[model samples]
Target: MAGTTWDIPSGATVKVSIIDSTMRLSNMPTTMLFDNAVEDFDHLDRIPTWCLLVESASGRKAVFDLGAPTDFDTYAPVYNKLMNEAGLRSGFKVEKDVAQVLQDHGVAPADVSSIIWRSEGLPVSVHSSHQHLDHIGNPNTFPKSTEIVVGQGFTKAYCPGYPTNPDSPVCETYFADRTLREINFEPGPAANPKIGGFRAHDFFGDGSFYLLDTPGHTTGHLSALARTTHGDIEDTFILMGGDVCHHGGELRPSPYQSLPDPLTASHYPVPAGLNITGCPGAALFGALQTSRGRRARDEPFVDPSKQLQEDYAASGRSIREAQVPDAMDNVFFVFAHDATLLGVVDVFPKGANEWRDKGWADTARWTFLKDFAPAAAKFGEEK
Candidate 1:
């Protein structure tokens, strides 16, 4: 397995907030995210895409991921068709783009300063976590001065998108007049020892924020780690996990946090209510069914191979270990597709910079378990 250890500079800190683009989707099959399941699973999951806005104590600003496009069908037809066929739809109302979201939160579009995938320019430049339609949104929607920064290999892989490629999922209009920059990943101090085997680029050069090369969910996929502070304490980090895993379960019940033993379940509260014990991670599965009406195992629910871009099992293990309970106090994960977060942490206008004070991690740690309660109950009955 790839190493799961991360290196955080002692006393390093930054200001981070969750940007609620106010996007939402109605449906997604559980099998697409997990193995061992039945197809056409109507999870009605809140497929929300979120971006993270980070500010250094010195006032340098950066935004990650743009959430969803309001006019998605028109922006990217191929994506629209695929999503529509899969029962997914646009999630937000009109004018909910990133620029508007920033403006609504008191930061005018002109104040953006920079879009950090890895550092600034209201020079209107934005950093895309990946090329997915949802993450790119309508970059064209930004001011004419805006440019876009993407991970390495982006243009070569999907350039001449849309009409030119005919089947490309990205909009040519989005990149028409914009300057696109790709980050070149080099083995540095962050990557020499390996943080979950990820090649990281220190965005701020002060060790306060890092853009990790975690390429599994999609090619050139990137995730971030931002050091933050509560009151006097430092050495805390908030991980902006971009599409790492759609649901929390995929990275929970780690070796560091197995299902609570029944004797200690009362202390945990949430999982106790579901009466779940032992490692529930393995028991939790997708909703795809076999030809004989039994739930499918080791079978993909969607086209091509599984949606997982790399070794799925290894990726899950790396994430789970990196986010164990001992690390929760100083580290927490903010996944792009986790809707359970809506109720747990303060949204954009209100920075999650104070998550530690709010006990946000503890509150959300087990919320994903509720989705598996029925399965857990059935397992209990069988036992």
Candidate 2:
């Protein structure tokens, strides 16, 4: 976890924006998050596959995740089947593709210079946060000239994707003939000890963007940290937390911040009847008998160390510590699936670089806690 810190030059700025693919889907509770309960609520919950657009000061532009695809059938059969079983097979339509979203913002697929996974290519490359279908967003949809980037160990883990593997979730053509650069996080002796508990590589080499080695969700999952503002020594940053923590609640309520009561929380428009005046942290769902229900104290939970999906809870804890409240305006954690950000921050064409002024971090801080309102009301008082 040791790595050197890269310094951002003063006055250098990166234009950042949240691009809405407008792709939405209804999912069972435990599908997006591990320990949640769907049967406890009356209906299913939905979230958007939000993407990011980061443009460097020198005019180099790159896109983060591609969000969901308009023509999802183009993806591998294995992915299609999984989405089908997960109830996410049909909600996707073409109009919300990442290409369309970029065009709407006056940028075209041909104009982009790089495709950084999890985060860009030329006018340079297309990068994936990991190999997940939603994160990759049908990379073949991008211009063929654009290079594809991934985190360390990607090729060895999933190189001959799809068709070849039959059950592979990625398409083989995505990496075929493309400049697929896998990020090697091995830092030299001069590098610092660590960058937020993970190895990091200064992506631009100029200190503006850093590719972090945050594995857990998948074999090669990666996250990006961008310096939003330059200061004397330490600068402010926007942590593009790919799939590290799907929900805000998964990372909030650290030592630096606590859950906001109904009256103080401003981001979410609390309904007329539900009043969690003094709500504590996230509301916990009572024990149920579902296939993935919580195990009793006597029963053993899955050892995170051995899970093939990586250490989700450990990743959540790392992100939580990085975005603590007192950590100053220096850090803003943007998990890919945090629905609370839908209206809090402006979308593409309107950059989220103004997040500090807009108080977006504080606004959306405790909004996720509201999701448990109904469950809390039905159960006893907040714990």
Each model's TM-score? 0.77, 0.79
TM-score of 1: 0.77
lDDT of 1: 0.59
Candidate number of the best lDDT: 2
User: Each model's C-alpha lDDT?
Assistant: 0.59, 0.60
Which lDDT tens digits does candidate 2 get at residues 1-383? Answer: 11223333333568788888776655433433444433344333557767888888787887877776777787777666665664555544435778777887689887766666662210000132112456677677678777777877777766577788876666788878777888888878323224656777776656677777776666667787777876675566788887766665445444444333333335445445775554322223222111335332112111222222455665555455444422445577787777888778888888887687788887776676456455544454523
Error of 1 at 323 (Å): 4.4
Candidate 2 ranges beyond 4 A from true positions = 1-11, 36-44, 91-94, 119-132, 189-193, 231-234, 260-268, 272-308, 312-327, 379-383
Clashes of each: 13, 34
- Badly placed stretches (over 4 Å) of model 1 are 1-5, 10-12, 38-42, 84-87, 90-95, 116-132, 188-196, 230-234, 262-305, 308-328
**Model 1 C-alpha lDDT per residue in residues 127-159, reported as the tens digit of each score:** 221124466766665664555666655677667
